[model samples]
Target chain A: MTERDFLCLTPFLIIAIAPVMIMVVVSVLRNYKVVYGFSVLSLLAAFGSIFFVLPSIPHTIEPLLILDVYSMFFLGIIIISALLVTFLSYDYIKQLEGVREEYFIIIFTSTLGASLLAVANHFVIFFLGIETLSISLYILIAFQRSKSNSIEAGIKYLILASVSSAFLLFGMALIYTAIGSMQFGDIVAALTGHDPLSLLVRSGFGMMMVGVGFKLALVPFHMWTPDVYQGAPAPVSAFIATVSKGAVMAILIRFFFIIKGFNNHYLFIVVSGISILSMFLGNILALRQKNIKRLLGYSSIANMGYLIIILLTGSNKGIQASIFYLIAYFFTTIGAFGVIALLSTNEYEAEKIEDFKGLFWKRPFIALVFTLSLLSLAGIPVTAGFIAKFYVILEGMKAGLIVLIISMIINSVIGLYYYLRIITMLFSTPSEIKLPKLSITGNITIAIVGISILVLGIYPGWLIDLIIRFVSL
Target chain B: MNVFFYIAAVVAIISTIMAISGRNAIHSLLYLILSLLAISVIFYLLSAPFIAALEVIIYAGAIMVLFIFVTMMLNIGLERETEKKWLKPCMWIVPSLLAAVLLVNLILALKNVKSIQPDEEAILPKQVGISLFSTYLLGVEIAAILLMAGVIGAYHLGSQKKKVKHRFLEIN
Candidate 1:
């Protein structure tokens, strides 16, 4: 490979190398704090690398991967989320004993894998990136082996994920048999001449959708999501909900947009049905959930459904809106989970809704951040989630999906009940239970995310414009 | 040659069934090996000799051996055999139905097979090798990393603390 190839690949390489380097450094010094610092620095460096390499627009490293404005946008999201997660982990892991520094390593590796997925252009790269992310996640979910719930979540994810992988592989094989190639461009070319109703192609496409649908946690395939999220560590749950889903959404947008499958009415109808079902079901189910993490889990499924509305539109505006919404959701969700991570102390997890009761009385700053995040999730004004939902609704309207738009609106209203319930609980009288003190690092992380949510909400013009430019490419 | 194909196909189907239904893990693994070898033969017949070779080397040889070694180390001996649940008959139904349907479809599809149009330039190994090194080099490297990670994972799990057994009273 030439220097240009190396230059184009630098950001990905930096992400991959950072974790191993940190592992080595941790082994020598045996200092968790130092390891945490190194992880944060590496992620920041990765974030900076995206800017440094900004001049080379739309550069393909090979047939397998492309490094462009689209990828850099999501890479920025992943890096920022990883930075926050690492900050959260500094205190989260400190509360538990006998945990090694390998937690950070897994986190960083998963982030790298997510970034790779955002840029993958070939089936092979896509599969590799996904497996890398999922395997690391399986380990991360069960990192606390003594916790039976954690182990159960890990096993459930493994079995379901393996089945999904099989479906995806079968889809790829069928598509290859029909089209003679596995690249996105080639698939599009093959699809152009064929009738959309062909059994082989349709089955292949359906199976592929099923595979991706599992990751996005759409209805029917969403059974494992709540259980897994509820069982995983809070910060890791946040990472899975945001970074993992964001990366997959990016790739999905790329795949659908490149293949131009939205023009097919059958596929569009199916996706629309899924979106509608997920929005209503996710909201309704979350209303009855007493556990905050599982509630957020269902809420995320609903959010993904709303996001898929944009993809169903199959327009440049829709793509831009989806990217913008993903960014907004990332900040809000990560910040929300960051609060949970801070409150978790040595003997118990701050997962129960009762635990968050009277949080405002005890820790006003954290309570305020949590309130803002929940409101944003509820799509209240003056927060990023509101703007995102507005943009998505506008795109849905533009595509003339009136029914879907109505469903999203109704779901948003229904979603308000649970979100407000959390807020009200936070403001109730402080419980006799004492809360843990937040570390400076965790506090800074929360503050940054909180400010980001508000700033993006008010002045989303710049980010929207950037997304529009990237989507046009 | 056609008789060999039929024989291999039957062997593959039966071994696959055994792999799923066998009560013993080691027996299941052995059946899996046999099925993999049969699939490799099918791959060779389909003019994918390189894939056939890799299938045997990677799946039957390396992966199966790893499975056997892990099963052995876990000490799932005859004493544990009695614990096998009565789900064997149920487990065989779905795969058997699937295999039967697939075989019937294959037979129907192959009834009107067209004669091969031989391409003078077609060299299966060379084309596959070239593509592997050029377009799929990253995949090749990633597979190596996967194997390495598997080794590391195995070592990590194996080295964890093992429960100590209590000694009984001396019987001298």
Candidate 2:
């Protein structure tokens, strides 16, 4: 590797070292505040290091990774989301009984995994990055062992994720057998010579989609979404919803564009079918949902379905719209889940709809933040989701994907119903139960997320300009 | 070499079946080890000595030992009656038949695919080590981090401790 490669790898290197440093500090000090402080600082340093290497990017670290503007942007997103999750995790982990310090370690490692996925160019890095991310998640999901639900979710995720990973590996093996190379560029080069995809390559791509679909929780593989989301701690659920999905989406976008997979009408139709079904099925399932986390989980499925329409557009504008939507969705999701995490008391989680009964009466500030988040998710006029959906629909129209755009529009309407249902529940007669006091970090994190949603919603031109300038294939 | 391959393949098939059908966890594990060893022998017959050795050392020796230790520590006594009830002929028969059909399909698919010519020279362990360190160094580092995450997760989850009350509330 050249000096330029290491220079461009600054963010990855810093994140990789941060966990070891945290481990050392934990062994010596055993202080929660110290550990949390270190984690936040490390993530901040990692985020800053992206800019430090910005001038050196558009460089590939041969055979494994590529460092470019696109990846750097995503690494920024992943690190920032990890930072938000860590901030939210503080109070939630403090409420747990024992071994809370180790939580930050897993978070750091998982963030590293997610960042790796953003720049991965080979099958090896793709598999390793995903494994690292999921393995860390298995522990994070089940961190609160006192709750059987947590353990059940962890086991379910572990088994299903492993099965999906096996399918992915088999698919990679099949592709490698056909092309004698596992690099995306090589596969594309080999494929351009053939008019139609070979049986092996086609089957391999299908199996690989199964794994990706499971991770993204697209239709047919989305059964685990609500269960896992509801079972996991709210902060972990937020992490899964944003960082995990976003990173995979980043890689998928890169791979698809590289392979020009959209040209194959069969694959295009398959993706279109999946997206439309996901939109309808996801929103339809959440219509009468009581659990807030599961409702958001279903909302996430529909959101991803909307996002996938951009893939069909096969234009830079589509990619920009997807990134903008992801940014909006990230803040909205983190803010919403952060509220849930804050409201959760010592023993019981505030997951059920009834838990938020008359929340507006008791804590108007918290309730307002939660309301803004829900409004953003529902794509109300002033929230970030509106502009995101508008941009995506505009791009879809330009690309002539009327079917997907229509489904997305209908799903948004269906989505607004459930989000409104929760908003109404928040405003209803106040329940007599007392809520937990919010922490400083949690409050700050939610405030940031909430403000970003409004700012992005209102003045989205700057971010759009930034995306057009920096984010390119 | 072909005769040896057939012998090892049969041994592997029988041991795999025995492993799955066995009620006692330890016995099942031992049968699995045997199956792995037979597969390694088949690998050796295919002239992949390095992979053969790795199969015996890693799968049969190291990993099987870990599995055995965990099983022994857990002390999962044989529930033969439940196993018998659950493993009814009808339950196993259908899936087994389906899997057999899949095997046939796989064989047919392989027959259509033109096989690449195998290298005449055997791949040495040194070559594997060199390539892993030099060309695949980043992958190695990533794998190390992955294993570190796994180890930390395992340690944190496995350690037994008393559930302390919420710290802020405890002092109050």
The model with the greatest DockQ is: 2
Clashing pairs in 1: none
List candidate 1 segments past 4 Å from native.
B1-14, B69-129, B141-172
Query: Model 1, A1-473: lDDT tens per residue?
Result: 56777777777778778766875686578788788778888888889988888887678856887877878888888888878887888888876656457777778778877888888888998888777778777877877666789889988998998899888888888888888888877888878866555778788888988888998899878999999998888889998998889888889899988877788887888899889989999999999999999999999999999999887787888888888898899999998999988998757888999999899988999999999999999999999999999999999999998999999999999999999999999999888888977788889989998999999889999988777866653
Q: Pick the candidate with the highest lDDT.
A: 2
Go through the candidates in order and give each one's DockQ. 0.24, 0.68
In model 2, state the lDDT of residue A331: 94
What TM-score does structure 2 among the candidates reach? 0.90
Which residue runs does candidate 2 get wrong by more than 4 Å? B1-31, B38-47, B72-119, B162-172
lDDT at A211, model 2: 88
| Residue-level lDDT tens digits of model 1 in B65-98 | 9998888777656535533442455544544554
- lDDT per prediction? 0.82, 0.88
lDDT of 1 at A206: 88
Can you tell me the CAPRI class of model 2?
Answer: medium
lDDT accuracy of residue B63 in candidate 2? 99
